[model samples]
Target: MLHETSRRRLLTGGLATLAGLPFGGVGRASTLFDPVPPLIPIRALPDRIFRTTVCLRPFRAAGPRIESERVGRKLVVHNYGHGGSGWSLSWGSAEVAVRLAMQAGDRDIAVIGAGALGLTAALTAQRAGARVTIYTKDQFPNVRSAWATGTWSPDSRVAMANAVDAGFADRWEAMTRRSFATFQSYLGAPGDPVEWTDRYTVSDLPPEQARGFYRAQEVTGFLHMGDRIADISPRSQLLPPGSHPFPTPTVMRNSGMSFNIAMLARQLTADFLMAGGRIEPVTFFSPTELTRLKQKTIINCTGYGARALWADESIVPVRGQIAWLIPQAGVTYGLNYKSVSVLARRDGIVVQDMGPNDGFGFNDTNETVDIGAAFASVALLAELYERPVPAVSPRTDP
Candidate 1:
């Protein structure tokens, strides 16, 4: 029997071998020599937690507002309210907003809000040969986008199934694919701004028993459009009883890209400035205030701030919080055990409680960090490592 430390080293070696292959290449039989999969423990303790942050995701029942409207002499293109998908869909949504702004035949484009949407829009406009200027009150690190979960969740809380039109899925697919392709360009760059990592879902219950978890969490019935772009994402593989090292009875694994927001933000800011794009520290009290800008075309990427800035009551706030643990070397995977989700990124290890259901944070506008709640999530994660490893069945294969 392999000791805990030996198991981790073997797993790390297996992971290193699998890392160079494509996303789903872990399925290769050569990597399955061990009867039981290796385990890499997360040092999830209260003392290791460095910080906690809270952010409000702007959710619209009808989906993100990507339309053009006349605001005095300016053609304002609205591109906010992407909910939890802002980071995942920013590039594609930027493509749409820039297309609309360019239709106004303006050479100088102004982007409001320097969050994920704003930076991407400014960069995309620059790519379109426009002189872009970002007008915002705060820059990266201080912006709400900096507090995002930093995962590839394109359709997460993006829209309501009943509220959107029939054509919305097609548009969503285009945005997801475009954003996915653009993220691919950032791979292999310094600091690993964007890269793929394997994620494990650990559960005590079997697959059939856990199928109803989604139904229990749906409060507003948000649309699940992952199926539309299924071709791009790798399929989840169920780890056999003896093939995974977890206290839980069931484990499923999948590979997806995660963003190291701090690194990605720096890269994006440098890209925008190098391309001759400018950022001005400015704030707008209302839509009519946009007329004061010298650029005739403006893209509004205000996110949840739009609820007050535009008096848009339709934009609901979905609250989320992250508890950051000091980065642990060689811990590069993600985990979902119980309600807590943990991702090991270059910046920090992110631990979050997804709430009781999909509606756990729906319509919540609170931005205060709950230290107790954050610690509770860390406690839950610690439970996985504290419990004794379960016995595995013998391998039946030759």
Candidate 2:
């Protein structure tokens, strides 16, 4: 419980303070002597918005369930409940899930769901010499994972601080590192499936004052283990006044990897199929239904669908919505201003309202797209670029 106003400030300031700190990827650093490139302002007009999508991030207080359980005669390895970090922690989480599934000593493995976690788990199983088959109701772009923010946010709302045990941090760090390393391999892949880009965090308040808002959020009980693996990604650096193009007095910049979901999904699905893996259109209503599958080992990666399919009441739904604008050339970076965030992906420009606090949409399972909210988020970005850019002054040695 943070008040609405405080929560809004927390969302804005917290992102500027710790946005890309935990990402592990390749990026060039900016120096004082280097010339600052002019940023291509985002065209955030309502006419540019082509689609709106809503997704419920499966959030579990304790963190993702990565243990195995007996489902009748079959062994089901649970790998769901990653909250907002599903795409961010996929590879690493899959490593743990696949490891557990392999313990069953089964040559064939069945992966449930076809989202980020499921695809990664399927690929991980294939790499482990297991003949994998994915059983999912929908795949790729049709699934909820495709609606994600598509940024490298490894620890974003992964768990609640008070709800996790002491050992959770170590496991999270391991997963983050593994996921980061896996992303590097796709850096130069076709379609630019994974690549690093700059993110500018703009704030109207002064830097120190804005960070105070972030300090307030720290006591709100959200698990922030990004510091544990801070070495993995580049740190957010304060932009020198007049050296950056923004209407705001405070501007912080960081670089991290992003996934172009449209391209990445195509690549992942193709990789899975090319590796002799099979993906069947199958849906299960209960754990007992899994016993009918031929594979004795299974990795359950149903994501938000697990809340009903598995009857796990612990899984809370964090409602998130995104408004996609037509992609613009030369607009490859990201921006966070107010409570709104914009990411220019290969497929489209993603605009999102991150809400006032971590609990902004907690326990809210409504997946209906909010047209007004989507337009409002884009309007904020429109207002940002409308402001006059301050004149740059010559720098002098102190």
Candidate 3:
């Protein structure tokens, strides 16, 4: 695990470790803004085989007792590991975790990591009338959640799935619905320039063959093999065009809309501040560190941070890199085929086609610029979308 930052800050309870700074340069990120902007097209490798991989279980940690931790002599809630669905399940998981956090019955609460999960956990706590504080390394825009292709698909990620009780899935389903409702709140402001692009996912056979794909296809896509995806949804609209210019046989809304992750992270930060949530912006180590916390209860929302401070092996990084194309800004919809391609709002036609071998490895060392590879992929999508999308990867997870 990349020790976010070797520098540790002294806190009242335990010490906090600052997240490792971005790879741009030492301490200062010189190439911070290299990926965003008046994005223009780039040349990628020709017929290059690109392997875009994400951890099949990105958030599942082999623990040093993270699921069971001590905090100020109170019960701590374990609410991480939604993988790509962290944002999608933010509210639901937080609701359950916060319920546990609240059961501790403390007036003050502590939240770990400030990514979408952390922010939502903090907000949920605050709403419950508990004063919440976030201890984090790299604030919002820097956390992994901010880099997510912000949609609503819980596919290709872990969420206590194959986890404990059957109730967990029901709980997740309810939360998913709740999250969709909550996402509506962050609509226009923070830059939801991207929205749910409802298009048909055509398969040669019938819908049953491709049933599960659209179900978990895009974590952000509010799919409704039975609903609608529109600009303005009466109830998170799900629109299905009878037949487009394509040959797509299977179809559903990828989700309601798309989001500029960086911007949404910023928006979430603002929401947290507005809700009166306190942020110490510090790091922590050792369970003994709780003795110094101003709050009695703590919520550990750290995503990958679990590996270091808690020494959790489950939170390993499924190294992923995006070949960002110049934003076809005019293009607001998104398309995803497993981990192959995603044309998002901020990051244009970005693809991280990691396969089983080198693609899925946790070596964040695959930042190759396969501009032509990306170009060819995008062109294919253009052709696909102009008509009907072909049968997608039949795999359950992306």
User: Which structure among the candidates has the greatest lDDT?
Assistant: 2
Q: Using TM-score as the measure, what is the rank order of every candidate, best first? A: 2, 1, 3
Candidates in descending lDDT order: 2, 1, 3
RMSD of each: 6.8, 5.2, 15.8
| lDDT tens per residue, model 1, 213-331 | 43454556678776577678665555556566787765666676899999999999999999998889987898888888998999999999999999999999998889999999888
- Write the residue-wise lDDT of candidate 2 on 164-218 in tens digits: 9899999999999999999899998989999998777778988777676545544
Residue 139, model 1, lDDT: 94
Model 3 / residue 52 / CA error / Å: 11
TM-score winner: 2
Q: Mark the regions of model 2 whose C-alpha exceeds 4 Å error after superposition.
A: 1-33, 217-219, 392-398
- Candidate 2 shows a clash count of 1
Off by over 4 Å in 3: 1-57, 61-68, 71-75, 159-163, 188-190, 200-255, 336-339, 346-349, 354-398
For model 3, the run of ten residues with the poorest summed lDDT = 1-10
Which of candidates 1 and 3 reaches a greater TM-score?
Answer: 1
Give all candidates' CA lDDT scores: 0.81, 0.82, 0.50
Write out the backbone clash pairs for model 1.
Answer: 217-357, 217-358
True lDDT of residue 332, candidate 1: 85
